[model samples]
Target: MPTKTKAKSLPDGQLDHHAINEFKDVPIRATIEENKKIMEELFKDSSDIVLREFDIENGPKAMLCYVDGMVTTSAVDDALKALMILEGNAFSIDRITEQTLPVTQASKIQFYKELLTNLLSGDSVLFVDEQDTAVCLGLRGGIRRSVSEPETETVVRGPREGFNEHLRTNTSLLRSKIKSPRLKLKSFVIGTETNTNVVLAYMAGIVNPKLLEEAEKRISRIHIDGVLESGYIEEFIQDQGYSPFPQVQTTERPDTVAAGLLEGRIAIMVDGTPFALLAPFGFWQWLQASEDYYERFMATTLLRWLRLGSLFVALLAPAIYIAVSTFHPEMIPTNLLLSIAASREAIPFPAVVEALIMELSFEALREAGVRLPKIVGQAVSILGALVVGQAAVQAGIVSAAMVIVVSMTGIASFTLPRYNAAIAIRMLRFPIMILASIFGLLGIIIGVMVVVGHLAKLTTFGIPYLAPVTPVDMSDMKDVMVRAPWWKMKKRPKYMGTSNVRRQRPEPEQ
Candidate 1:
């Protein structure tokens, strides 16, 4: 016989166990009343649990247990009606699962842990008198956001469909694109309390076995209380936590995840979050966008170069301005120097102070625009920047030249393809600006070297963060420095260590 110990209470006078570990492995009871008592004890003071008791027609007593609003009540009612009207005199959980349950998805569960897991995941569990096992019916339903274009990662010429919070829906979206038996989504239950389901998606034959094993090891090592989003998993499993560059690339777009999977990379998706994570990410990927692959290679190459220009501007524009105005004025053109000097003559703060005030204000306004309602966010951000910049210029708090520089820098930052990458650049800007103010151009050089050194040292799942660049792989450069036309590109990325290297057959020689 299993023993029941008194559970301790918390300061708030609630049970502290929370069904974490104490009752997980307990076997289902042969007696219905005893099982009901245990469930009632587990869910004490909870209003959402629904345990409906009924008798099968000419058979044993039975009950349906589910969380209200999670399982579809109409489906549950239909299943119950079917069970009540059964004509057979002999009945068992297996018999009902095989013949009676109208639901398409149903399974038999024997342990309390399995029962709780199913019930909590929106399945209806049918328990019968004298039966030690319960049938878990697939009746999960509730209001969920319909799949729509992602707000974060929009593309002009690529597929607009994005991942939603529903885990099954996301997997189906990926499946529809790949349509191959080789594509596998292995599931794992994480989060001790939330019991969040996480799926590791990869192409079986193409992905390196060692990479897959390493990914699994990292995921299994995570022991969090709950995982509310994919971000939680990214932070836990990534190779470097403190690096500004994202070791794990996050995407809300299914096509992006599909692209990553096809390249012999693996993706991690969590339940209840639209964002999914891709591993073994490289620096060049941050500069590339989904639209880059959709358009002509020539156009994509030009745009990539443009983004490269913007990246440098976003990262070093303000620092350069501070360096030039404060220490290297002689390096500037004579006429341009006079104009810049004239603009800042009446400014009350040093060039660095001027840049900080404007940069911080710009960042704050950008954040406010994002958090506010979309209708007014743009208007407010634009109007706020205009008002603040014009007023500061008029009051001599900052120079007109500084206003122009900061505005251009902010615009440049927006051109980068990835939001997190833009954030990293934005964050690095301030320190670089301070460096410029102190040791002038040399400080800026030092900062750049430090950042580069960090990038060279970083790795994601054992793949170099700056792959095909630091450790040059000429074969992979076709997709990096330039987007080679589809015909010329005949192989997947070499850094991923995939076994299946060939992506397409050689272009027919004219």
Candidate 2:
């Protein structure tokens, strides 16, 4: 005999528990009805929830359960029509079992847990009364952005379709790209209250077991109540808790994720977020873009170097200016120095004060441009920069040379691939500028050394943040400083813990 207990505190107040002894040696047909009764009890209070009850004529009566708005109506309708109208004439329980349902025009999916998992995933479940099993029909729906190019990662050449919020759709997009059986996806639910789904994707046999284990362990330790975005999980699971630089990179492009997986990096996909996280990221990783892979190797390499140069200019240009004007006058050309002195002769503020004022104003204008509506933002930024620069110079509050230097520095910082990394540079600029104004070139060197020391201490998933450079891997440098030809990139990134090193066969001598 089976004992059932009703749940009082649950939302439905109908959750039922059956003693294991009652189900022992029981027929599957009997077990299914018992399971249905339990589910009915569990979901009683969810009135909007839909559960379709139908029969296979002379065979068995069954039910389909799904959340109202989470499933496609058309899909469920078609499935019901197929079961009731198409197969209604033939009503044998054996005809509709998992083994026979596909032949009888219904998709047959086995495994009890899989059925429950699919049902909970917004798919309609078909429960045949006489049979002990159920079939979960794949029909998911929810409000999601239409397929469009990613705003953050716009490409002049390449696939423009970005990942959408829908997890299944995103998985499908990835699957469509890499049809190999080597591609593996493992799912876990995080968050005690939210129960948000987190998926780990990679190429099995290629990915290092150690890396996978570490990633899994970190994710499992997350004790948060909610995981609303991929970033939430990233922050919780990143190796270093103090570094401002991002240890995990996020991308909206399926191609990027697929490429990363092929190279043995783990891709984490959170349920509600379109952005996926990739771990074991390096400082230089932020500087590379998907466009780099799409364009010619030479063009890509040149653009990368240009970005690197721009980064230096962004970080060091203002400090250099302050140092030269305050203490290093000899480093400046005699004519340029004379001209700079002539302009500064009328300025009321010191070199540091002028630099601070201009930099702060530039940052404020940039923020305004970002927050303002798209139609007016560009115009506002351009006009604001021109008016502020001209007014300050004309008022004798700042030198014309200072305005040019600050403007150039601002523009240089904008060239960075990652916005966060750019902001980090922007923040460090002020301290370096102040130090340079106080101690000239010596202060600048001290600031650089401090920044480098901090970077050396930083780690991303146990791998040094400045890997291949600080550690100095000659082979990895082929891809880091320059965009190597695809063939030359035969091995996976050493930091990512990929078991399989080679991606392709080596070229034979011609």
Candidate 3:
């Protein structure tokens, strides 16, 4: 897709709008020299591209062109050996492809651009002297990252295997969990220069037709220079493109994706990225984890409440502390207020400034921990927080009460299952803290109103971002605010509009 970046646009500023070039329209020449001329011109100064010309026994002159490290050398050697030993009197593309190739996958490519796409994707192309088409051998093999347990979405009692960067492997992982024949995996080529492979996985009958169409339409509308990862695809297809809250759910765990698909959601998987994007997702889904489904329902139910509480604390702890300590001292208990006032006796900054200073410093230390080496990052975050909080308090820059509030808030944030959700709450803290300083508890109320309004207004592909709660679905309350027992969860999410609504049969007698 070298033409991706250079693709000429129409007068209205649309991509791929130019007339087809004569080069792509040109058929492979009967003579080997003419074809070789075009090939050499296309790959002018490339050193890694290998082009081998040889005589085929009882066949026309032939050439094999492919990238160096993409294909196995021994496979190519064996293919040559097999081609040369054949005693056929005539060259036929079908016969050659069906009989001679030692590999499993092969196809006849007709156009120049198609051949280029295949060769670039790590397949070897065999060009016969007088044939107008080329044989594409599936020889893609090289070093790839091995599949292992995902570091971020780890679970104690579920499948430990996580998705790797390979597209086929990820799809296979989904299929293994969902053994139904209706599971569909469709491919789309995105990014002009990278030509990355993106797959859309969904169940045919279970997925909503309108939702699937919308997702596919959004993906087709993206004509970027390159798509290096699934994040690239995620941004392109998300509903609220500018919203801080994630409209798309990202997960590296295979079980998570499989669960989403079973509930009638479509997944987008990009090559060279372990993370996959799930569509038509809601905010509550982020609070749910893989372990929630695997663990006992009672335990998961309790954990959900803890996560919900943590989310509020992460977002409002600092703001509330500032309001209560500064302008609403009567709201606090007398003893706590005295303790907070004593701690702030020598501090020179106002409540808002004090909170912001500590919050920003803690956030910086956290970022340093993440950006540093893993072993060093853990030590830096832990020790940096301890040292900075203690030193700031002793130096009389911040109160001990403020330090405790910030620490508790940080702990609450880490309790979130999804990093993206936690990040949204984390980033929103500063604005609310400023609001708290300006108007005390009233400012906090205004900020909460604004956030709730935005959340209610937001939608992910026509499904409410704050689904079940905002739409006020009475039946969905079982799973949204709390985890219902396995047998109690008798139907799929109402928004899915799936044909088969019953998720399971009635529970049998004990």
> Which candidate gets the maximum lDDT versus the true structure?
1
After superposition, the stretches of candidate 1 with alpha carbons farther than 4 Å from their true spots are 1-24, 506-510
Positional deviation of residue 350's Cα in model 2 after best superposition, in angstroms: 2.8
| Model 3 worst lDDT window (10 residues) | 14-23
lDDT tens per residue, model 1, 1-510: 977553443456444344444446567878788778777877889999998999999789988899998877789889999999887657767779998889999899887777787788888888899989888899999888899999889888989899999999999999999999999999998987888989999999999899999999999999888999988998898898888888888899999999999999999999999999998888998889988889999998998888989999999999999998999999999999999999889988999999999999998999999999999999999898988889999999999999999999999998988888888999999999999999999999999999999999998888888998979989899988689998888899888899798899776889
Q: Where is model 3 more than 4 Å wrong at Cα?
A: 1-24, 87-91, 506-510
Clashes of 2: 4
Superposed model 2: Cα runs more than 4 Å off:
1-48, 51-64, 82-120, 125-135, 495-497, 507-510
Candidate 3 lDDT by residue in tens digits, 246-347: 988889988999999889899999988999999877889877999999898889989999999999999999999999888999998999888888989999
Task: List, residue by residue over 299-342, the lDDT tens digit for candidate 2.
Answer: 99999999999998999998999998889788889999899999
lDDT score at residue 313, model 2, on the 0-100 scale: 94
